[model samples]
Target: MREEYRGEKGTTTTGFDLGRVMWVRKEPSHDGLIVPKAEYEQEREEYKGWIAKEIELRGVPGQLHFKFVRDTMRMNTDGVLMVVDSSDYAMIGDASAILAETIASFGNIPMEVIANKQDRNDAASPQEVASWLGVESATGTCAKDHESAKNALIRLLKKLE
Candidate 1:
């Protein structure tokens, strides 16, 4: 998220911001099928693992103009990556309510919860965050580290596959 490969490092996003990046991963193999071209029916390069050639990462803000965006931003939404502050214990309730509202609005779709700011002294573990948010699993990540942030996306893509 710090602009090492894609997206400019900036302040909090209050609206839809797009980030296009080709993320290639080999480990934690993808167990999904890739549609091949008609002429090359047997070729399966697209499904070798997680290879997202292009992805539009958007920030559907939680507080700023949220109701407007939430009501109309469901077109082609592949999945949602929910990031919560691991250090801020009080916001879990609000986050849970928002999460419930998201599901109530979007139906059953692919989603991933991330407990970010792992570097903080008072940060919660991913498991703790998950339990607090009533989710099965939540990936641990810190925004400053490129690999950490990328792993969060990778995990979400893996779920999509």
Candidate 2:
């Protein structure tokens, strides 16, 4: 998180870039545990397209690689920085626990979450998210908003430091 840029305002610090993953919500059918088959299939195809696009943007070679466990999707990473956004779903099996477990499973790498449109919800706050993810710290940000996201990036970088 060291300052990597200089300007009239002085030094600017940047955060690491974590790979991105989009989580989609599945609609349930008659069975509470099961999502409607057609709806689920539609979402599946959409996400697959998204993953392919991300790999292309990254310019990765060979076929794109990924998997899902406990409703969370993972990218095949070989020790590279990754940033995961869970804005696609409202709540994924306890955000805090899921994030903690994900990071742990990913070898304790510095990970971040952007609570997209989080301000819309009266109940969920960044601090609440931090507490839930079992992370001592986290930033609440809207990815669509550049200014807010930039500030969040700074915080994430500082955490790395």
Candidate 3:
């Protein structure tokens, strides 16, 4: 699935491989999530081939920084995947605010809210998460379940297309 081509500049060479990158693991705990160091490192290495650059943002300041990063990156992004922890009810308000801001800033770009950790006993349903976030839909996905993750990705990709 790997393909190489010249960029718009003609001189620049670029390549892409169609695949999946699973980076997080859900453990048996209240939080029920674990990011293995080795897996994270592997994910980073895989991403290096697909992404030109990456930026991490947090809080209001990070949100502002995102604007700068977006402008500087100038990448033709097709959509946004907003991931939410289904069990974290406490952060719904903050998550909703961010979702609203992102929707307003992006202006009708395809977006999908993934309610991850669906396997957890205390996990909220996708419908509940969507309602809480004020979104029309949310895809329930358990990261550890390949089928669930694949279905979620398929849904997101469909929206992107």
Q: Return the top candidate by lDDT.
A: 1
On residues 1-161, what C-alpha lDDT tens digit does candidate 3 reach at each position?
87776663324333332122332323222211123344555666644433221212111222433666644432455666778889989878767776777776778988778898999999999999999988889989986787776566545555643
TM-score of each: 0.71, 0.40, 0.56
The RMSD of every model to the true structure, in order and in angstroms, is: 8.1, 20.3, 16.3
From the highest lDDT down, the ranking of the candidates is: 1, 3, 2
**Residue 81's lDDT in candidate 2:** 21
Instruction: Judge candidate 2 at residue 123 and give its lDDT.
Output: 39
**What lDDT tens digits, residue by residue, belong to model 1 across residues 1-161?**
46455765577534332354444444446422222133122444654645434466767767534868866776788889988999999888888888898898778889989899999999999999999988899989997786787777877777677
The better-scoring model by lDDT among 1 and 2 is 1
Rate residue 65 of model 2 by lDDT.
27
Ranking of all predicted structures according to TM-score, beginning with the best and ending with the worst:
1, 3, 2
Per-residue alpha-carbon lDDT of model 2 for 1-161, expressed as tens digits? 79766763544443443233222223211111222334445566654433121211131211122223322434654222223233434454444444555566777655556554554646366666555556565666664566676555444443444
lDDT of 3: 0.61
Question: Among these predicted structures, which one has the highest TM-score?
Answer: 1
Over 4 Å off in model 1, which ranges?
A: 1-18, 25-52
- The deviation in Å at residue 130 for candidate 1 is 0.5
* TM-score, structure 1 vs. true: 0.71
